[model samples]
Structure formats: C-alpha cells, structure tokens
Target: MDPTGTVAIRARLAQAAAVIVTITMLAGTADLALTDVFVGGEGGHAVYRIPSIIRTTSGRLLAFAEARGSQSDNGSNDVVVRSSDDAGTTWGAMRTVCDEPGRSLNNPCAVNLTSGPHAGRILLMFQSYPTGKGEGSVATGFDGPYTCRTLVMHSDDRGETWSTPRDVSRQVKRPAPVTSVATGPGIGIQLVSGSHAGRVVMPFNEGPAGKWRVYAAYSDDGGDEWKLGEPAPEDNAGHGNEVQMAERADGSLLLVARQFGGGGRRKSAVSTDGGASWSTLQAVPDLVDPSCMGGLIATSSVGAPCLVCTGPASAKDRTNGQAWISTDGGATWPRALPIYPGSFAYSVPVVLSDSRVGILFERDSTSKISFITLELPSNAAPAAKTP
Candidate 1:
C-alpha cells in the first residue's frame, strides 16, 4: 500500500477504536501526533559527548553521555542520563548518573540482561579515570599515569537507584602499577551455548596496539560470585575496540569487530565452538568503519538470524554513516542505507524487538550528541541476498 493509504488506514482504525471505547482517543492521537518527532539532537544539550543509548524490555529509551564541563578546567566531566518512555518522542531532563569525587567517567554502554540469573537487571559498563586527568591522548590510546579502570554499575529497579560501582578489572591479573593499557569494559553480551553459558561476556581493548579482547565472567548465584573465562583466540593484535557478539539461530556465536588500525574497515570472525576457536580475520565487504565504534544486533525475524550494523560508509573517514544488514549470518552483507550524511562519530544503532532502529551518535566535532529513531523499510533486502 502507498504511504498515504497506510497513514489513513491507521488513523481510521485509531478513531474507530476510540469511538468504541467512548474515550478521548482522538485527543490521545493528537497528543501523539504533537510529540516532537525524532529529529536527532533537536532538544538535547549543545555540548554532550561520548553518548550511549539502549532500550529496555519495557520499551523505555535510555540515553547516557558525558556532559562536558566549562572550558576553564572545572575538575571532571559529569555522567548524565535521560529517558524517553514514549519511544523517542520526548526525553526527560538529564540526571547525573555518576558524579565522581575526583575522577572523570565516559564511554557508557548499557545492556538489559534478559536472561540468566540477573534477568531484569540493567548493566552499564564504562571507563573511569583518576582525578584531574582527561581520557589519555588517543595517540597513546589511554596509556598514561591517570589510570583508567573498567567498572560495572547496575540498577535492579530501573534507573531509580544503582549499586556501587563494581570493579571487574580484578578478574584480569594486571601487572604491577597496572600500566599495561586496560581501558574499557565497553559492551557486554550474554553467552548462549558456550561452556560458559549464561556468563556475561565483555569485550575490551588493551595495549598501545589496542588488541581487542573478550573476557567472560559469570555470576552463577546472581552477581555475588563471578568467574572469568580464558581469553579467546583470534584476538591477537586486532583492536577489538567496539566488539559485538550475537548468538545465531543455530546456537552458534558470531563476533563482529571494528579494526582500530589504519584503513578503518570492519572485520568478522566466527566461533563455531563457542568463542574458543575462531575463524581467521576476514574483511566484511561493503562495510567500512574509520576505527570508530558501531552497534550490532542479531535478531531472529525472517526464519533465520539477521544482523544489523551501523558504521561509516566512507572508506577512510567516519563522516558517512550507514546501516548494513546481513541475513546469512555474518558471512556476507549487502544492503547499505545511509543514516547520516555528514561526519557523525561512533554512532551506536540498536534494534528493538518491534524491528525499529534507534541510533545515538555525535552530531559534529563539538562534542554534541544526537538521538534518532528510524522505522526500517520493510521492503529492504539484505546485502547478502541469501536468507
């Protein structure tokens, strides 16, 4: 059906239901219509940075970022968060999630653990730096005296209150003085079929080369006693800066990575034996990323596992960001649609259960963040053209 016809049918249906219920259905519809459409950063602060967004099982949209302080050196950055109960229509006032005494926190990644022991918990992973220090110069890749630690903060009752930050870095035996390039607990996923089934898997980067690695730590009896898994193969020298893993329909796991080295292209590797043994690094054709972090989601929609990744379309820059879809696992991807034309840094795209796409990315070079929601075109086909 045509777009106009679809809109008219939906409106008529809503109105008819309102009349049947004898309530102000039309008014509610009008209010929804008046809700500010998702225009990216239309109503957000002008100077937000390092934005991360996630959707809850109840459909609440939560966005978190580092609200930069004044230029005159005001101590540290503030970790702020906002929520949208009605999809992406409107957002509540920004609230400080973490205000450290003498430290700065940034690069927030959140996940709603729907399975395992902590089923309804919301886990937030971010990096914390010591007092009076900015995230180390990118040239050094966070190798400095400031000391950055990976922390996990969780909320059991939604966003109302959070448990004290739990240091997961202890799981990894760090060298004396702890100066060997440990920066992030960036993104986490739940393992489905591995020996460490139901364990929380977090992908982090270390060393000047930024060799990205995946660490598995499971809390068998809730978040009380946690065990760490051995390092998986195929992560040597590859900067797993922003790692994403998804369990395929066949119970296998597919891990996607963005290379931080030169060329800025996306790479993929498969773990048939549940992340223990992985295939060699192979380039994912048609997906280009400029060493920037992107988001990936695996869903069982078309009778098979479908994957979606949002990253740069340009070969050498992160200015042109696009969304690519894969149908036959991660073997190949073909469909590419532009999400933003100009330079947007490290946008994370999330797929909701209803198939809608939510992306939060940096607007310009000025540390501003924008949020956008798109209803993916149903007629769009996967680039692989298989499943």
Candidate 2:
C-alpha cells in the first residue's frame, strides 16, 4: 500500500475509537499504534529492561521483562510479565513469574510447545546469578554461589499461573571455562518443517562477557528434556552475544547475534541440522548494531517468506529504533521503517493474528517497555528453495 493508504487506515481506526495510543505514521507503513505495557519505578520496581514478547497458543500476548530493584544489571531482579488479550490494545495486571531474595533472575526467553503430551505449554528459561555478581564476576563453573545457572518454568494456563522453576544448568550450560550464560534475552523459535519438525530452539551465549560465543539449547520432545548444541564457528568479525533465531521456510535456521565490541554490524549464521551445528558466522551488511540485543521473527505473510527485525538503526547510539523487512529469507534487508525516534533498546517482535507485526521494546532509557504494531507491505514473491 501507498503512504496515503497507510494514513487512511490510521484515520479510520482513530474514528472507530480503537483502544490504542496512536504514536506516529511513517511513509508506506500502516498505523503504528503504541501502548506502554510496563512503566519504570512502578509495581515496586526501579526500572524495566530487556523486553521479550510472544503470542501464546490461546491467542494471548505475553510481554516479559526484568523488573530490577535498581538500575544496575547486578541489582536484585525478577522475571515479570503482563498479558494482553486484545493484541496489545489493553494489558492485564503485572505478575512476577520468577524471583529470588538475594539472586538475580534474568533473561526471560519463552517458547510454546505445539505437539506431544506437553503441547500448548509455555516454557520460560532464564539465568540466575548472585545478587552482587554480574557477568564479569560470575565464576566459570556449573554449580556455585558465583556461577550462573539456567532454570526453566512453564505455564499451562496462559500467563495466569506458573510452575516452580526446574534447574537445567547441567543440560544447557557447559562447565568450567564457559561462564556468564544468557538465554536469548528474547524469544525462541519452533521448527515447522524438515526432519526435526516440532523441535524447540532457544538462542544462547556463553563464555566471558567480552569473549562471548553463541549456541543453541534445544529440546525435541516438546521441551521435555533439554540438551546443548554445538556452538557456531568462531568468526574473525566479532564475538557473538545476546542472540535470536528464526526458521526459514525451507527448514534451515538463521541465527542473528549482537557483536560484542566490534564494528557496528550484526553477525549471522545458518543451521541446516536443526540447531545442532552452524556454519561460519558472517557480518550482516545492512543491520547497524550498537553492541545491543535485537529482535527477529519469521513470517509467511500472504504466502511470501519474510523476516522482520527490530533494533537501533544508528551505529553510534541506541537511538533511532526501527524495523527492517527481509523478503529474501534474511539474505538482505532492503526495506526499513521507524519504530521510535530516540532511546530505544532490546526489542522483540511477534506476528499478530491479523497478519500485522507487533514489537515490544524498551525506550526512554529503560524507563518504559512499550509495544507497537505495523502492517507489512505485501510486494515480494515466495522465497526460492535452498539446499
């Protein structure tokens, strides 16, 4: 659609009094409605950061973030979430899904099982650390007060209630020498095709903070038993950290990651064996990175295979939040649209029921976690097959 047509859609929605806060309309993109789902210093938390969003099987939108007691990364933090039944038009009360008295429960990565006995269950995985220990101070072991541990929880009732967290550090994290692990800080993906169909793949990063390496922790029996996968081949471009994954229509997986202190360009890899191994990493020429995590989602809108990415468009700062559309199965991003003009970081995107895309992101220097939805222009043809 044209720019004028996009504006008309916004005008009609406003006339009908939709329960949304219309932010701004960019050229050639549909109404970009904004909703502040989590506010800083509210609900007894000092700040909110690291937004991860997903739509459940029951069609409920669950937005998750770390509710920190202080602005520091090592401050007392809890994994909290809020749900919206109307596609983010309105949100329910905030609830804490994981917490500890003197520990930090961070990185809320979630995925929904679609088959087997535990089908429809939502699995949430996060990392736990001592209250005063950040990535640099965390030890390189599988068990200790200073070591990082991976935990998993589930909610069978769609964000209303959750089960007790189960420790899976042994299954997911490697021992001594690989420390300071993070589970996505974004959402996970489930394969819909290929020999390993219905597999759950969650992006992960390990090793010291600056020397970080990316891998995948996966489950085959609908999240029944978790196991670690081989790490991606090291690239001379940069060290990978805080990653996200999306499966292509041809069944291969594409992993995008934030480069830890390299040039301002995102790194990517491909996996043909269902996340067990990956090809050598390469720098994404189009995505401008600021050493911050970004969001990614794959969709087949109108039968065209495409990928939507959300991140800071500027190479120097975390400002100028924007969304880029990749119709060629993530080979390149030729189209871009603005999401926020300033102070945006750590975002995740989900495909709404109406074929529109919803991005939940942190803005205003971690004071607010907001959401926005936009319609993708349907112009590209279906993706060609790859071997």
Candidate 3:
C-alpha cells in the first residue's frame, strides 16, 4: 500500500537505533590492575624510592625500598627488601637489606618484635647516607664511620638474613644542627599499649635538605637499645619531614609528620609519654600530600582504636593515592580509601593478617613499587579481630 508499509517503517527505525546505542555503550566501567613491586630497571636497581610495608609475626609480607643507583634522591642508596608469602600477590627475590658499598644505605625502617624478649625478631633501621664528596657534608669529613649515620639490622629467619649494621649513632643521634638522621622512610611500631608496653618504636628525621624535623627512636631492651626522643614539637607547618608511627590504645604515641615549608595538611603529633614529648604540631588537613611520605598504623583488633594512613591524597602533586582511616585517634580522617589514581607518592599501611589493609606505595613515576588491599569504610570503623 505505501511502498511495502514505508519499507517496514524504516526497518523499525533502524533496529531502534541499534538497540539504543548498544545499551549506552555497555555502561559502567572499572579496571585498575597494579603489581609493580619495585621495577625501575629491575633486580639490580636504578631507582626505587621510599616505601615500607610490614606484617611479619610469622605471617610475612615485608617490603621496603630505596634501591636507587642513580635517580638522585641523594645517591647510590641501598636498603632493598622483599617477601610476600602470598599477600601482595608475589615477590621474593630482591634482598640487600642494607648495602654500605660506597655509602648511602638509604631509609628503610622495619619492626616486628611483637612482645617482650624480641617476640619474633626483625628490626631493620637505616640511614647510611653519604656518597662522593661526603654528600651532606656532615660536620666536615669523608671516609666513613659517621656523617649522617643511624644503622641497625637484624632478621631472624623472617626477612631471611640480615645483621651487620649496628651503630646506635650515640644512642640515637642527638646534637642536632641537622645534616642527616633518617631511620624510617616508613614502617616501625611495637608498643602494645600503656606504660610503653614492650616498646620498639621508630620514626625519625633530621635536616639539611629543607630543615626537616621529627624525632623518635625507642627500644626498651628489645631491639637491643635505641633511645632518642623529643624534637617533634614545632610544626606550625614549616619543617618536619617524612615521619610515621602508631602506638595507641592507651599506651600513647602518634606521629605523622611531612609538612615541608609549612604548607597546611599532614602534621600530627601526640606522645603522652611514649615518644618522650610531642604535642604542638597538628594539621592533618585530611591527609593531603604534596609533602609526600605517609604511612601510620595502629588499627587495633578491627575498630575503635583506628589510625591508618597512606599518602598522596594530593594537595598539590603525587596525584590521588588514598586510604586515610583514623577514628578519633588522629582526631579525624573520616574514611578515604582511593589507592592509586595517577602517580601516588610514598605510602605504607600494613595491618593485614586477615582483616585486610596493606597499601605499599610509591608508584606512577618513582619507577615502580606498588600494592593495594583495603576494606574499611562501612560507616568508617568497626571490626577488631586484630589490626
């Protein structure tokens, strides 16, 4: 009648516009696969950066960083480590917990003593720093021995093999005028609670780069000996550097420095008695970071005693890497959880036994070294089998 019914009505409007554009082009989308566990030139090093993940009471999942042979964070660094008994997916090769070849041990901090008599061995501090022309020019010397020192090593069948460096740096490096003293680009905590239960803390920082600040170094007979506390007080936002710690439930202690020239976010403090003294600096602008380096622990059981933290929530750079929990401990972090979006600077969470929460970062451009695994935000806190 009308030319075959108008050609079957334009072929049913061209198959209803191709099924409405393939159902809105397949709708929702998501794909984020990461696993670069440190690969900037690989195996032999070239540039690794600072990251520090831990979780060994026998459970295993120790990871560290700062391999660098030349990417310039200072120079010829070392302090590599690896191990993952099936947590971060896979990782086992890279060792070198601290190579002092020409000097530049880097900043790798570890801790897993657990209880009293060194509950399970594994305490790796670092900071050899000093290359070529005496690098930071400590006081005015070259050779070796001291010039920004702070070494300490040990591993009892967990980190595999390590135990050579042990220069208390005169207890824990005092006499500040600043030149170097970095133990812990991340990872270190043992105090169980109150009265400094068991103690083993570690979270340090000195100066010579931008006038950094932040101090802490405990032991109480566990890691043998490791004094040095009191220095993290002045933090309106001007100095303080790459620090991180967590020991609270009642014991007292909570550091989280990394504020550079006094920008704004990320400064935290509070040591009731554990870290000796620390109370001034408090900014935590919601865990932002252009100032980089973050990773504070203390997750207790599963809820209440919370205080996570991973970096690059971004205030200016490193992109958006998240996972900032905190439940009234650091005062407020509310519940973030982004983990990798662009570059993601330094990070280190570790609280997994089963509760889940491993975040070992420094990805996007620092060559490699990445990890993720979180689950905390069902209202923001509640679950305590052990964190």
Candidate 4:
C-alpha cells in the first residue's frame, strides 16, 4: 500500500467525526486518524523526551515519556504517561508515574505481561538520580552521588493508576566496577518461545559513558522478581548506549542499538537463552542511524515472520525517519519506509496481537509527539533468505 493513502485515511476519519487513538483497526474501519497524545511543553514541562508506548492486553494504549524541565537529558525530570482507550482519537490527562524529591525519573521501558503470574499486569522500569548530579556522577562502580538506580512500578487496571515504585536497583544494577545504568528508554519484550517462554525482558546498558554496554533484566516469576543477565557481548560492536528489543518469531530476542562515534550504522545483537546471554554483536550496516534511539517489534504481520524497526533513516542527519522491515530475522533489514520526513527524534513501535502496528515518536514542532498506524502487506513467501 502506498503511504500516500495515509493522508486520505486521515481526512476520512476527520470527516466521519470519529477520533483515532493509538493504532486504530484501520484496514476495515470506516476511518483512520493520527494524533499526539502528549503535546510536550504544554504539559507543564518545558519538553517531553523519550517516548515508550505499548498497547496493553486489555486494549488500552499507554504512552510514556520524560517530562523534562529542559531539552537536555538531565534536570527536573519526571516519568509521566498518557493513556488512550479509543485508539488515538482521545487521551487522558498526563499522570506522573513516579517523581523523586530531588531526582529525575528517566528512560521508561515497559511491558504488559500476557502470561505467567503477572498476566495482564503492566510493569515499568526506569532509572532515578538526584537532579543536580545527572550522569556527571557516573562512576564505574554503583551510584556515585549522581549515578541513577533502577526502579519499577506496575499498573493492575490498565494505566488509569499506578503503584508505588519498588527499588529494584540491586536486581538490575551492580555496584562498583559498573556505573551509569539505564533501562531501555523504550519498550521491552515478553518471550513466547523456547524454554524461556513467558519470560519478561528489559534491555539496559551501563558502564562508563563512552564504553556503555547493553544487558537484559528479566523475570521468570512474572514481574515479582527480575534478574540481570550478562552484559551485552555484541555491545562493543557499537559505540553508543540506549537500546531497544523485540522477540523474534523463533523465541529469541533481537536488539537494535544506536551507533555512536560518527554514526554510519546501527549496532545489533541476539539473545537465544531468553536474554540471559547474548550472541556476538555485529554492525547493521544497512540501517544507518544518526546516533538516535529507535524502536523494534517482531510480529507475523506479513503472514510470515517479520521484524520492523523504526528510527531516523539518515546516518549523517536526523531527518527522513523511517521503518526498516527484516524478513530474515535480524540478519538484514532491506525494506524501508518513511515514518516522518523532518526533524524526527526518538521513537517506539508496538505490534498488536492482530498484527496492527502503532508508532509513537517525537516530531519537530510544538506538539512534539505524534502517532501513526500501518498494516504490513501480506506475503506468503518468507523474507528472502539472507546469508
């Protein structure tokens, strides 16, 4: 389907007076639309950064971000979220998930449990640090006056309300010799394959700033207990931190990370043992990223296994944001389509059980965050086998 059709669909939805929220059931629905759930600066914060969106099992869409006092990563930041029930046509007011007295709650990585003891439960993981410290206190060992600690919160009734945060820093972070850890800043995954089926996994990275490496914080007994996995082995293959993950059709997890150090290509790695360990890292030379956070979701959208990744498509600049589809797992991402053509920043993708895809991302204007839904064209032939 030509993306040009999106404009017509939006007009139709507006004509019908039906508000589009989240990712609508667009294929058969009479109308389709796109809207921003969070309008940044207007939400009492100077800017909203870091978008992490997910459609709960109950069908509610929760869009989370950091309400920043300034565009910079540090300062008076709070983890806030807006929810939608009618897809994207309407949204609830912004609610603070967690805010510390003098600390910042940054980088929200969340997952809705579909299986296990916490089935239907929504768990959120983030990092917290004193506002004044920022990453400046990032010592190679533990939270040095400013290095952040990992914390978690959950919602039982969709996203209407949340519970108090439980400090899980010990479970996901290490002391001394390891510093500056961050959880996702995007979406996590629930494995439905192999021996580790039903495991909850969150991708995180920590170490010194320039040498940060990725790791997984996963739980087998639902979200009650999370354990840190070995540091991402392929992480050294890339130059930056801030990672995102999706579960492959075969049950393994695929990680696509932003490449730093001149940013010619993205970095990638795979985990076969439910994120407990990772395979060697490699450079995804085809998916060029300009050192920006991206999104990924593995779903049988085309009637066969497919992995869709979203981020700015430019390596030298942050324009021409697009989604790259991989048919042969994560080996090669050849299919690319534009999501936003101008001033695109961080983005996150969620694939519903029915194969509908919803992307929430940051745009260049005042409204800041925008969402769009799309259907992956069906193809019986498997993604052309790649080497």
Candidate 5:
C-alpha cells in the first residue's frame, strides 16, 4: 500500500514540475515583443544596418536598410526595403530599392510628400560612393565617379516600384572642406505651415571625417528639385553628424544630430526659414547619445504637440535603446522609456496607425534590423500643428 501511494505522489510531483517549466518559458518570451524586419546575412548580404523607416499615405509601413557585402561600411552596399501591410505586424519580402554594381549606395532616407501634385509620392535620398569607397576615402567634388554623389528616387505606389536614381550632388552638396556627404539615415519631413509649407526637407551631413557638420536639402515644388541650406554653425562643444528633423507647432524646424567629437550629448539646431538656414548647434542635454544615429519625428496624433526620439540612452556605449518624449516641441525631453536595454544602435522612429511609436533599429555589432512599438504616455502631448 505504501509503495503504490509513494509512486502516485511522485507522478503528481512530476506533472507539477512540467507545468511550472511551461509557465516559465512563456514568461520569458512574453516581453520579447520585437519583430525582426531585416535580419543579418539574409537576402544575399553579409549584414543589414542603418535602418530608416516611414509610414506611407496608403497605410503601409516601409523599412529600409543597407544590405552590405561585408560588415564594413566601405564594402559594396545596396539600399533595400520591405513593406508591411498590417503595420509592422507582418513584413513582405525584401526588395532592393537601389543598387549600384560594384559601388555603394547608403543612407536610405525616405519621406512622403503630404501636399501639392506629388502629395502621396515617396522620395528616397542617399549618398553614392565610388567603387568600394567609404566616407574616409571619398573626396568633395561634383565629379561623377571620383567624388561622392547625392541622389534621389521616387515611388508613387507606396514603395512598390522606384524610379531611376537622379544625381542631386550638384544641388545639395557643398564644395570645400566637405569630403563626404550623407543623407538622413533615418527620415525627412515635409513642412506643413508658414511661408515654407509643403517643402520637402531632407537632413544631411557633410564630413571631413572628424569635423562633421549638419545641414538641410529642401525642395519647395515637391521632390522635383532640391536646394541646400547653410550648415549649422559649429562650435568648440561639438560637431553635428547623421541627423533628423521635426516640425514644430510654430512652423519652425528642429534638427537633432549625432555629436562627433563631443561624444555624450546630442546636437540640435532650429530653422525658421523652412530649413533654408539653421541656428547655431546646441547640445540636447537630456538626450544622452553615444555618437550613433538616432530617430526624431513629430507625432501625428490628435492632441498636443509631441515629438519622439529613439536612440541609446547611454553616453558611452550603444546600449539601452529608449524613447525620449518632448511635449514642448522638442524643447526638452523630460520623459524616457526603455525600448531595449541592450545593444541598440542606429534607430528610426515612426508614428504608427494605432497611435503607437514604432522604432526600427540595428542590434549590437550591426547584426540585424528589428522593429518594436512603444506606447505614448496617456498624459503626453499630441500632434503638433502649424499656426
């Protein structure tokens, strides 16, 4: 009697243990809610890095990144994109947006024109490098194949197809002391108010490697032509690099950039003339950056004026991905919530259809590009509207 009873007790205990293990497994994965939009080493590439994302007017999400031949930035790289119909819940196949045989096309900056004849058209701006060349090797000039070139392409059908790449280097690039120029590795903005309303503004950075500076390349008649703005005034504190822009409620533009020499804090500047010229660069004290590309955008919801930025929270390393919210038109980032606590680099944030902020970022060591959605605080500011 005792033997049979003891055997039955052991069986019950074994069942209980299995149930506990199952619960633990579910618990571990319950909070891992990120979607891998572009995985590393997929689609005939060695790595996928420098993510840029946007939500089209047709209610589709497009994520773009650099598909590289090797992990190095100087290698052969192509700009690729993937679209999602259900708002990042699912993704379509990877489509190569732009590719140059033996050359490298990087920084897939995208923006959707919200007004005028090309209101729904999407424009992508990127920098084309010479064969196997990178930022350090490229020189500043208008020469087609020897110097770096800035190009643009458009898609009217919500990223289904792209037009031929047009060279805008002569229009958007500065002549001297600028050895290399790169487009917003994130996204651009279209002005909605004031004298410059409906202007498509693209953020760009010119570099001699260490002394990088930020500026804007804008088009008023839609994406047909582009013009360069004066570079942000540089100082001893920091030099701007890899930047993004947001429109304020008062119709001004705010640009946030990565600080090259100054290390810890993000650099910011403002433009009242629709990015024609920018104010002096200032450090965003609250946005602790590690010299990596960050995402900045104005929320498109209905409430107060809100701006959201995504990047690493650490000042020393590219870890701790977090969302910094500013209710006062990016005047101050008082609220921050963690997106990922480890290994986040080069992120692009977009406003989703359900009023959530979606951040597409590169994981540690330039491995993959992933997407995660974060909810805005209930008391946070709403969308900004020009007066």
Candidate 6:
C-alpha cells in the first residue's frame, strides 16, 4: 500500500478487464438472428395488403404485395411476390406478380434502374382496378367509364420473371367521364438528376378528390414506352395518401406524405427540380401517422445530408413503432429510437451494404410482415455525442 497505493490497485484491474472484454464482444455480435418473413394466402383470411420491400442488385430481398382475399379494403386484389436468400432468414413461397382477372392490384413500388435505357431492369410500379357494379361513390368515383390504370411492370431477372402490366397511366389527362377512379398502390423513385435521368417516379392518390399527386412515367427503351409526365406540383390539398418517394444526395426529391385528417400529421415535399417542381407541405416535426409507410434514405451518414424514417412515432399508438433519424436534411429530426414496442409495426428502414439496418415491417394485430435486423453500435456514438 505504499507505491502510490500499489499503482491505484493496478489501474483498477485494467479497467475491470476492459469491461469484461467489451461485454463478450457484444454478446457474440448480438447473436445476429432475426427471421420471420411471412406472406399470406391459402385462404387463411387474406390480408397481406400494402407491403413493399426492395433490396436487389443481387442481394435479393424483394417483396411486393397486395394479396387480399379477405381483409377487404375492397374485394379481389392480386399483385404479389416474395423472396429472401439469407438476409431475411427465410422466405420463398408467395409469388403471383399480378393476376388481373377482376383487376385490383395495389400499392407496390420497386426500382433497380441500372441507368437510363432501363440499364438492368427491375422496375415495378402498381395500381390497377376494374370490375364493379356498385359501391363506388366519391362523386361517382370519376363517373364510371371503368378502367383505372397505373401500371409499369418490368424485371430483367431479379424478380425472377415479370413484364406485362404496362399501361403507365397512359399519359394521364383524364377529365370527362373517363372514370374508373384512380387510387394508387403508390411509391416509386428513380431520378437522381434532371432531364429525366433514369426516370421512373410514381406517387399517388389521384381521383375523387383524393388529390395529392405525383406521376411521372418514363422508360426510354426498356418497359417499352411509358410516357406520362405532368402532375408533380399540381394543386392537391395536403391530404395526400400513403406516398413515399426519396432520392436526395443533392439530386433532390424528397416527397413524404401521410395525413388523413385527425392529427396523424406527417407531410413533406421538396423536389429541387426533379419530380418537376415541389416544396410546400411542411410539418414532419415528430412524424405521427395516418396508416404509416416509412422508407427514406439519403445517406452519407454523418458527413452531411442524412434522413431515415421508419413508421409510427405514435398515431395515438399502434404499438408505438419508431426509427426516425435526421441530420438536418429533412430540416431537423433530432433522434428517436424504439424499434418496435409491442406489436403493430410498419417499418421500412433499410440501409444495407454492410452498414447494417434492415427493417421490413408489419406485425401482430394480425397484419404480419416482419424482417427486422438492426444492430447499431459500431462504437456507438451519434445521439449527437455528448460525454
């Protein structure tokens, strides 16, 4: 106890053996395991609607859905497909990428535009409807001439096989009684720069005053001519349906919307000259929900421009899903965590290339759609790093 108290007890036993070897190597890399990738249909109460997961370039984890056989958002629907090689643990059954025999394929958005001329193809946009005789009144839902369209299907391989829903809204200029009421299956993005650089943008909720539009169709020489373009900044109240578009590493285009009245406020718009023109629909402070849909990535992580939003901050609590991180790109979003509290989740959070952060949401409350794999803490420090 003399030599300076035995060198302070050997520096507190080497800082407690470096905190027990850094908590046993983070408990063996957090046992990296997360596997639950269900996609329903076997007459088990059809309710696999509104799923859109994408990760391809050969890494494969594609999911595009709308397989209603029951949970009726309006009878018969189809468009479905699923895949996962190992990343999502396991999934390979469901597959029916658009079976229109009563038309009703909803909400799907995928992109893998290699570059202009459909450079590698893997583009799929969805929204189709036809087959009715009643229960259609949003002022006659476009006054019945029945033929709702918004399709653009293509796959140069990754999705295994596909290519036939090609009526990209046929230069949308509807006015008269050309009604079949359009409501999308909306979400698509691929236009890193101007002059339609590899264009393929789908954003929906069009007819019957459901306004909130964003429709641009272009496939230079790939999906065989899909022209339509002109409605990026048209006047539509902020009630925009479940639209989510993203591409912002300066090649600006952010569009994030969701608001069906009753205080689930989440709205954003910015197109710095890409989706035509937009920027006036703010209010994304804490991101509530109106049937949440989240997936946005504009990352350089901390070097600058960062944005990552994964559904449900609390729309009066649907089990409280979370994942909202912004580094001053979407104009401030301090930091929020909580992956999935209890059940009802609707995630989209994706950021892979080894950076790790993959979330494919929807769970419990019987919605069932999961594939969560998030393990952050490479040295953990980005809550704006304090002490």
Residue-level lDDT of model 6, residues 55-126, one tens digit each, is 776778787667777666445677777788766656787778778877666667776765666676787776
Which model scores highest in TM-score? 2
C-alpha TM-scores of all predictions: 0.74, 0.91, 0.32, 0.87, 0.88, 0.29
**Candidate 6 whole-model C-alpha lDDT, 0 to 1:** 0.57
The residue pairs found clashing in candidate 6 are 107-185
> Which candidate, 1 or 3, would have the higher TM-score against the true structure?
1
Error of 5 at 102 (Å): 2.1
- Model 5 C-alpha lDDT versus the unseen true structure: 0.80
User: Residue by residue across 1-387, what tens digits does model 4's lDDT show?
Assistant: 123233222333564243353322223222225566667668788888889998998788899998888876767789999887866557778898888877877889989899998899999999887776656565554445566788889998998788899988888887776767888778888888889999989999886677777889999988888898987665444464778888887878888887767346788888888888887667887787788888888877777888998887677677656777898888987665555556788889887556567788888742488777755655311221112
Q: Report every candidate's CA lDDT.
A: 0.56, 0.82, 0.71, 0.76, 0.80, 0.57
CA displacement after TM-score superposition, residue 324 of candidate 1 (Å):
0.5
> Would you give me the overall lDDT of model 3?
0.71
* lDDT by residue (tens digit), candidate 5, 1-387: 011111111112222121111101111211224677787777888889888888998879999998888887757889999998886767889999888886888888999888987999999999888877778878768885768888899999999999999999889988877789999889999998999889999999988887788999999888898888999997679689999999998999999999887758898989999998989998887888888999998975536678888888778888867778887887888765566656899999898855577789987666878877766654433221111
What are the clash counts of all predictions, listed in order? Answer: 3, 0, 9, 11, 1, 1
Q: Which ten residues in a row have the lowest lDDT in candidate 5?
A: 18-27
- The runs of at least 3 residues in candidate 6 whose Cα sits more than 4 Å from the true structure, single-residue gaps closed, are 1-48, 51-67, 70-75, 78-99, 102-107, 110-124, 127-186, 190-198, 201-245, 252-294, 297-304, 311-320, 324-335, 344-363, 366-387
Model 3, span 117-209: residue lDDT tens = 868988888777666423256642223455777778888888888888887877776664666778768888888767778888888887666
* Sort order, TM-score high to low: 2, 5, 4, 1, 3, 6
Runs with alpha carbons beyond 4 Å of true place in candidate 3: 1-32, 39-43, 46-64, 68-101, 108-126, 129-145, 149-173, 176-180, 187-294, 297-307, 310-324, 331-358, 361-368, 373-381
TM-score for candidate 6: 0.29
lDDT pick, better of 1 and 3: 3
Q: For each candidate, C-alpha RMSD in Å? A: 8.3, 4.6, 20.9, 4.6, 9.5, 20.1
Superposed model 2: Cα runs more than 4 Å off:
1-29, 379-387
| lDDT (Cα, tens digit) per residue for candidate 1, span 50-116 | 6667777677877776655542112465667788786665677677788777776766767677677
Candidate 4's C-alpha runs over 4 A off are 1-32, 140-145, 234-240, 353-355, 365-367, 379-387
Off by over 4 Å in 1: 1-46, 70-75, 132-146, 172-186, 191-197, 209-238, 272-279, 301-304, 381-387
